[model samples]
Target: MDTAPKRILLIDMDDILRRTLAEQLSAQDGLRPFPVASGEEALAHLAMHGADAALLDATLAAQGLIPALRAGGLSGPLLLLLPVGMGVPIGGDDHLTKPIRLGTLLTRLKALLNQTDTQSASAGMDDILSLGPYRFLPAAKRLETLDGTRIRLTEKETQILNHLCRRGGTAPREDILDGVWGYGAGINTHTLETHIYRLRRKLAAGQPLVMRIEGGYRLATAPVPA
Candidate 1:
């Protein structure tokens, strides 16, 4: 399994505090922190490289940063650092009083991440992800046709399909490999190709539904809910 560190985006205008928090988070076992001086910087970073969660200074929320991040496609849990005596704000998943207690921050952040993980697992079990004419039940490793015919998928086949579907129906092969098979699984392009071949054979949808693109692969149509 890929045991890479979870990325946390730390947004704060206080250079001293941001740097200190970033340093502290970096020292933790499974966290990698990216500290930004402003909301604009945070958005730019998020557009290019996504974060698993965010830690935002509450003052920035007053400036409309929360909606902007959401509009920019950041779907991570956001933890707000509020000034003492302030009530919970509008857009944060959770909050911590300023003059932050490091222990408390870690605890709350981890809890939020865990909650997100649990929710995602639940969604995978229940949500029928759609791509073209099929409904994909990832947790069950099965696909359903419009007529309710079920096609059993291997675990790896399900992972590959889900990965492609999540990436808007097109993803670089390297990213798909890392996402589905883990970075250090000793799996290679040949392994991926073999899986892709099997998956295509099983999909059985006419019109070349899955195709090899330049430097990547693409689905003929985008993913959608059935």
Candidate 2:
């Protein structure tokens, strides 16, 4: 959304299909698809240039997209599509099938990318992020403290922080509690407060306050400049 059209990473080993799909998405919707022939190519592309959403074929040659996605931060709810039912491991952004309904695929892709963009922008305004001096990098999952110290948080911590930060202001405790910990475990647990306290200690970084609402915690900051 940042004045930039959404980007897509569409992978298809078939040359003709790759070109056709990429062109369709790019030309029709202005979604840039970094089409590649192999899963490795997708990984390489991600290593160098990342995209807002990824469309990985379930049958991509070797190692699949899941492993690479786990390494990189290309994961979101929409990050797991299984088109073709080859039964091979495929993940990161929902998948469809070999003969997918074009409209449905595009709709799902747009919704996912839109959600990611919204969350990212919300996080930007409400939190100082990782680094104290250098600011934060959500995509990279790295944080730097004010005194020039680096703190590399685990995937879990980063995800939890992202959830709170994206909530903007005033996320209810029950909501956060359910989000951070699944409803299954949350039903009989007092761990929510403990985790929040721990997250606060590690991520807050004396930024005045990371949570504004007393009932619960939400990434709270004055406001970003227009």
Candidate 3:
């Protein structure tokens, strides 16, 4: 068993609750909690000293906290504390309903962190990759054709393609939204469909590159033989 202390960052506006959670976490063996009231404070803390995972209030999620943390370079596990009856927010490793029990919180947090550790030990994709007839550059958020043509992609578009390329096969609509837009169940799937439509139009050169399968979508790297 891993004996190292796990540092967890908690972002919530509720001072009493946040402090209570922090204290509870501190009492546990091999657990450390860094509680903050706002996204700015959370980012600052991460910049100075990183945590193993982060938990955010669902209210803060609507204000773009998740994407901000990701843009700030926090690749660690992120969990959302949702209020009762609230729809699931976009972009988190996992979520729990409010009036959260300490036992449940700890259980979910531990699972997400463990998953992160396992994924980290595996191989990751390179910055540059080939997608269909273009050389995909995820970092640059652009694609290049052989003859020197370049296509700029929106951040969402780039994320969509990056995810599809990583899957190496058809990706379910719900999974694509969760992975690409950080949106989970109840969020409109039309957002993903619209992006796919635009991507198909942009990538239409001579053959269809992005194809819609029965369940989801896939990247067709080459045309099928006649």
Top candidate by lDDT? 1
TM match of model 3 to true structure: 0.59
Question: Which of 1 and 3 is the better model by TM-score?
Answer: 3
lDDT of 2 by residue, 1-226 (tens): 2567666777767787778777778776557677887777777887788766677666652354565655675554323335454542422323355675667667667655655555545535344553223355555555665576665543334545666655653466667545543333235444445445555676564553355466666554532222
Report, for every candidate in turn, its global Cα lDDT versus the true structure.
0.75, 0.56, 0.74
Instruction: Answer with 2 or 3, whichever has the higher lDDT.
Output: 3
Compare candidates 1 and 3 on lDDT and give the better one: 1
Q: Residue-wise lDDT of candidate 1 within 1-226, one digit each (tens)? A: 4478988999999988999999999999999999998998999999999988899999998789988887786666788898788754455655678899899789778766664554446435466777777777876668888889887664456666777777889988878766654433343436567666766776667334568998778887787776
lDDT of 3 by residue, 1-226 (tens): 5677988999999999899999999999888999999999999998888878888999999888888887776767787899889976666656788998999788667756654554334233236776656777755657778777987654456666777776775688777866654556566436577666776677777456578888788888731211
Query: Which stretches of model 3 miss by more than 4 angstroms?
Result: 1-3, 124-226
- Residue-level lDDT for 76 in candidate 2: 41
lDDT of residue 131 for candidate 2: 28
**Among all candidates shown, the one with the greatest TM-score:** 3
Return whichever of 2 and 3 wins on TM-score.
3
Scored against the true structure, residue 200 in model 2 reaches a CA lDDT of 66
8: Cα error in model 2, Å: 1.4
